[model samples]
Target: MKRGKKYVEAAKAIDRGTLYDVAEAVSLVKKTAVAKFDETIEAHIRTGCDGRHADQQIRGAVVLPHGTGKKVRILVFAKDAKADEAKAAGADYVGGEELIPKIQNENWFEFDVVVATPDMMGVVGRLGRVLGPKGLMPNPKAGTVTMDVTKAIQDIKAGKIEYRLDKTNIIHVPVGKASFTEEQLTDNFQTLIDAINKARPSAVKGQFLKSVTLTSTMGPGVKINPIKVM
Candidate 1:
């Protein structure tokens, strides 16, 4: 694809079945493809139960310095004090009870993340059926619900990227634009990997550093050697 040429080229340079291999494969194929492997871009062998099942599993999170290069629309659920705080903090959408019915009737998803205050959880809870499936639900575990509306809105605007394991226990997200320099892209990649390493779930026994690959939107993927990074 137009966005993946650089990642494809980088993968070709590795000349090994690193995480880059999956990236390269994805880049080369015309249709979207999924990669499964026992090693990470760093070439570290995955250990333990190998939660590679395409269902329940825990992965990690990453905060992309450059953000996802996509504009994030935030929906804040608050009233009075919190509502004012969100508006002052630059929230794209902020309201209370009325907002829920409007969203339900419109089925709008242009927004990326949703934030709600503790007091407003009951109202927001009513929209679980609508927001949960879209992964836009406001949950305390993901830091999407807080009393500090200012900080919540600031973090969303600051390029905070949340990652979770897919059905295959692998986390995927875009790190940069195609126009970004290799150095810039690599730095972003390293930052994400470090975060993932730090988030290793205790349930995952043994070597937690598994396989990793870097690819772009509709581009070839390249696997990086984990050892070189270790």
Candidate 2:
């Protein structure tokens, strides 16, 4: 793969062999984001837990102290009072089964997150094939499926993010934007790290967090020292 000039320049700033502390990593990530637009800073965590084993699955949500710089658009599946509540709580799009065709046939996916009421899961189930692959399917564990749509919408709008182990046992989540102050990015990164640490599965053996890397969308990854993270 041919590397871009900006990427090559940014890569020069990071020492691939060195593991940096969280604060240093965050600073480096910001400095290396040479994109014209505000680049998103993301944390890629490689864990020892195997996602294939049900017991080893690691998944949960957390509210970043400084919300992700990107605005989150929420699509809520609810009916009657719950639907009204969701709209009242600031959900971007609120509807019930009617959205199925709009999404399936029209291929509309304007929202960033999907929030569904418990009763609407049956309705949501119909669109699982479409939503699941996009990681837009609302799960109860992520607080996206709940009777309390108000809290769910509020949390998401306020920077609530779900972190789950992918097929490779790596969890990727956006911490903040490169434009954010170093302190703001560090605070969000620490909050997310604490949440992941607390969600450690009991079935995991040694070194739950095998590796952690912080990087901007277009920057070379800045490795975070796992020992310092703990």
Candidate 3:
């Protein structure tokens, strides 16, 4: 496979030590180069850390450089003033009384995130049975419930990724693609790490961060030295 000139140029600019650190951070399990191939050359780093907890639990937020390559359908529950405010803010779905039943009937998971105004807590509270189990219920602690409907919608639409600590207390998310330039990936990786470190809960005594690793969908894992980023 022929590497793109841009990729080659990007690769050349990487400092060896920084590359090694990134390789460790991203956990590049396998490195291979095809002599003759039709596809573009790409590499994936797999970290040796389990992110199931991060994926399933770990409630925190991050704004992606490249918005979540998906359209986020927003549902807002507000009344009178805030209701109109949410709609004016460009929420895909907006309502008060009709919100719960609509969520119960339709596939609520279809939406990326749900936001509710302060007054809508009552409506949001009632749907706990339906939304809680799926981890879709908006919580005040997670900043999903706010009086700032405009900010909420804009932030979410801009690529905010939410994670919560589960029973195990681990958080995992895709930082970037193999096709991304090293610099681009590094920036994204740094942003995510910063978000995670700041998410450490006071209740979590001792090792707030047990260990860190970066891996791909299907790749070997590498252990990242947390100090490198600090």
Best by lDDT: 2
What are the Cα lDDT values of the candidates? Answer: 0.63, 0.94, 0.61
Candidate 1: residue 31 lDDT (0-100):
25
Q: Per-residue lDDT tens digits of candidate 3, residues 129-224?
A: 888877778877667899998888888887676766544445556565555555555666777777766755444444445455554433334455
Stretches off by above 4 angstroms in model 3 are 1-20, 23-58, 106-108, 177-179, 202-205, 218-222
How do the predictions measure up, each by TM-score?
0.74, 0.98, 0.68
Q: Model 1 off-target regions past 4 Å?
A: 1-62, 227-230
lDDT of 2 by residue, 54-102 (tens): 9999889999988998899999999999989998999999998889999
TM-score sort, best first: 2, 1, 3
User: Global lDDT for candidate 1?
Assistant: 0.63
- Candidate 2's TM-score: 0.98
TM-score of 1: 0.74
**Model 2 spans with C-alpha error above 4 angstroms:** none
Superposed on all Cα atoms, the candidates' RMSDs to the truth, in angstroms, are 7.2, 0.8, 7.7
Clashes of each: 24, 0, 18
Cα RMSD of predicted structure 3: 7.7
Candidate 1 structure quality by residue, lDDT tens digits, 1-230: 35455445544544454344333333332122223221122112232234654232544344667655567899899999889989999999998898887789987776888999999999999999998777777877567889998987887787676666544455666665555444555566667767766665656655555555554444444555454443
